[model samples]
Target chain A: MHTRAKLALSLTAVSTVLGLMIGVQYRQTSATAALGLGYLRGTVDTHTLTELKNLKASNQAAEQELTQLNDELNQFERVSSGSDKAMTAFQQRLTDERILAGITAVEGPGISVTLSDGASNGSDVEQILTHDWNVRSVINELFTAGAEAVSINGYRVVATSGVFCSGPVVRVNNHRLGAPFTIEAIGDPETLKSALDIQGGILDVLRMQGLNVTVPQIKQKIVMSAYTGSLPGSPTYSLNEAIPSLSNNGT
Target chain B: MIWLPILGLLIGAAVGLVSNWTIPVEYSSYLSIAILAALDTVFGGIRANLEKTFDDVVFLTGFFTNIFVAALLAFIGVQLGVDLYLAAVVAFGVRLFQNIAVIRRLVVTQIRAKRRRRFNTTS
Candidate 1:
């Protein structure tokens, strides 16, 4: 074949192959993405279930302890009443319980900043999942905003809960989260908003990443759990009596 | 054409089926092309180095695309009220079949062309 003819044939071949390759690449990537997302989504669902289950278990345990403490206090008060400072310990325990159970959705004033995917400029089908500025970054910002506690998608943030990615999905305390990450906080809403919207603040960071952010107040409630960790129960979570199962597995 | 991406998808599915049958995986998840590259080199399946490039592309596609499909599945699966994993498996299977069929046709066409070319020159 002549040079031009050969070039044309080669070009045609390359073009056809690349075209075909790219098409399948996109579809397969999308499918694989779906699979990963599905797995991650399942992980999130599992985490949510775990969260609820463990929290419930903790609540029950805490409640039992609180009831016992309260009974002891009633007896102590009836027996003697001069100075019941000893009850302070009991009261603190109950407070900790409420905070840990995530029943304490703080409501005074707070801010909500939304971070969208940074890849908006790219094609919708472009293979991108976790942006550099992810949910954890936002969570950090809220903490900086003097957020007493925070929650995303009803899953409360606790001291122990870590934020990171698990296969294209951001996990908080092992809870898989999708986009439009809702962050609830308990603080002075205006002040919090001010800190976030300042010239060189969280909003700026969000914009740099090409993510959309909006700060709003929780006119009603912001239930931020003190923590969302494992507890004794389920096939996965077993904080208290987890050793028995582990031992059984070994056996 | 727009169908190009579709063709790539089919090729990926072919990779999945071929790898699934020949390659042993406990979880059934694909080996990334990076890993497959090594496996191919180690086993030295004839012309595997060249083939690994293709498998790697397909494997990467499979890994990455699953995430997107998972998100969509979760969003839509809410309507059906089934668990997300089940929904995802169904979606993955459908994509697999679609991918396999397209690549099979492409390969057959290549073979037919080659045969016709040989016969014509001889005649």
Candidate 2:
């Protein structure tokens, strides 16, 4: 009888353990199964689905409109190119001027300067990052060194282009750019290198400020994209006429 | 003897219900196979008790060995990239059904015999 009681007790203990394991397994499996089912069914409603479809359709329409505009531009170019000899010559000069003004994409042998943030090493964060002034200074040096055309972070440095610090980032031509900034300039490689590397130049100034500046490396061919922002319309009046000098008028 | 298994089952369920601890998903498959093996042993134990041949040592050892061997098989099956746990499931399932069938027969016979004795006494 005692042995029989012992047997019952042991069986009870084992069964309890078995029950616990079974309960836990059942709960986990069901939980995972429900999650899997939820994912399979998804949570998107008809409204969201319709919105997505409409967005895709509008994107396709916009793309078609762009293609149509490009075609019209090409046709105008072709007609202008085949007109009178004098007109053709004027068009050629206009194209050359456009290239010089960075209104058109230019490709030629040039040098690229890459500037990245320097290691902080527990120092001031501001000193370790490339600032707007650093980018502007680099562009100034490149132009002074006879760089035919220059672009900073893919934004062409045209007459009206502005680079300024906005909070933690640098804004160029109204577009925000972060490190590392790749400055590509099309010019005589040797002249650009010598001008940038002159003793106590912009590079040394940037390096002293704890910014990681790469020495300009000459590339066999560099392609720069044209400025995409709208340019100011031609002035209506001649600048040769002197404006009436403004005097302090009593309010 | 009859109430012992029921008490064991109730205790086991209580312990399982009260504990919030859980095994990871990766080991759930092994746990499932162990559960199936254990259920088989429980049914086998009940059937043995009904037949007056139940042994405490055999029941206890069977419970542990069944879970260990089933888990090990599942682990090895995973290592070999094979569904070996299915085999354990099928085997345990077949035996479980067989044990339940016998238990059912034993219960029905015992009921019929009691009814016969009562009928004879009343007549």
Candidate 3:
């Protein structure tokens, strides 16, 4: 009876170990079968599965980084193109400044006035000759009539230009010019001619003096040369650092 | 009396299920071979008991030694890159069937002899 008891005990111990192993195997097989990977469970293990998962995660991360970099690149391109537009606008402003400074040639519809020395009519010599004042008066009247540009004897008239009487010739822009002075002004042709043809204006006065002055002739287009003379040298002036009030006004 | 070991096996199986213990995949093959060896020894022990040749020391030692040797053989087969576990499985399977057959025949003969004795007493 003791031997039988021992045999039962030993057999139970062995069966218990077998049962444990079978239970674990069943659990593993069932898990794989639930995933529809029962056929591959024997070949693939946890280590390979984890490695594959890690690889997939890294691939996703790399794709995200690539998209981020692509977005940054697009932003840089947009910014550069915006800067290019600003550069073109700045260049356009510079061209306008050059035109306003009278350093660039201009063309438009305008009128021309010619004055010459007339045959003496027993009057004073000044009355029979075209004088500097006559040219100055005509230029001033043209400007008042809203002339966009003006020239005399092919010389551009800028703000700093001087017209003076020198001997028998007229000195304009520091150059000597004789009779038959042609003053060209660019503006509305009718307005420029009407400004000079006003009753008892400069044209009528010049005509009364016997100084052979012709009526202002209108033209479809008059091309005037640019200012050829050198601009005034820049003065050796330092920045006005003392003007604190005006400094703050600069936005 | 004969149901004692079967009861013990069912109880052990229930305990294994309740414990939820599991082995790693690497050692599962060795466990399978060991289980096969244990099953063969159990059946062989039953046959010996029926034939009146059962020894306590031999049965107990054979039970443990068979399990250990089967697992060791499987481990060595893995090291040697051979299918030696299949050979162990075949050997244990054949012995298990043979032992079960002998047990079945012995139990039937014992039952028949008991019936014959009863009939003679009644007559």
Most lDDT-accurate candidate: 2
Error of 2 at A179 (Å): 27
Residue-level lDDT of model 2, residues A1-251, one tens digit each, is 88668767877777778878876776777676666643444434545788999999987886686567556645555555556674456556756777777767899989998999999989898898988899999999999988888998778888888989898888988999888999999999999988888889989889988999898899989889988776664221211111121011100
Best by DockQ: 2
TM-score of 2: 0.44
Ranking by lDDT: 2, 3, 1
RMSD of each: 26.2, 16.6, 30.7
Docking class of 2: acceptable
- At residue A180, give the lDDT of candidate 2: 94
Off by over 4 Å in 1: A1-82, A85-108, A122-133, A218-220, A224-228, A231-251, B1-123
Interface RMSD of each: 11.1, 2.0, 2.3
Q: Total clashes, candidate 3?
A: 0
TM-score attained by model 3:
0.42
**lDDT of candidate 3 vs native?**
0.78
Candidate 3 lDDT over residue span A82-114, tens digit each:
576754554466456555566768898999999
Model 3, residue B72: distance off in Å is 0.9
**Candidate 3, which CAPRI tier?**
incorrect
Clashing pairs in 3: none
For candidate 3, the per-residue lDDT at A19 reads 66
> Could you give candidate 1's per-residue lDDT for residues B1-123 as a string of tens digits?
334434544564555444423322222222222222222222221122223333433433443354445545554555677666464555555555555555566667779999999999999
Model 2 stretches with alpha carbons more than 4 Å out: A1-4, A30-251, B1-4
Candidate 3 C-alpha lDDT tens digits along B80-106:
999889889999999999999999999
DockQ of each: 0.02, 0.40, 0.22
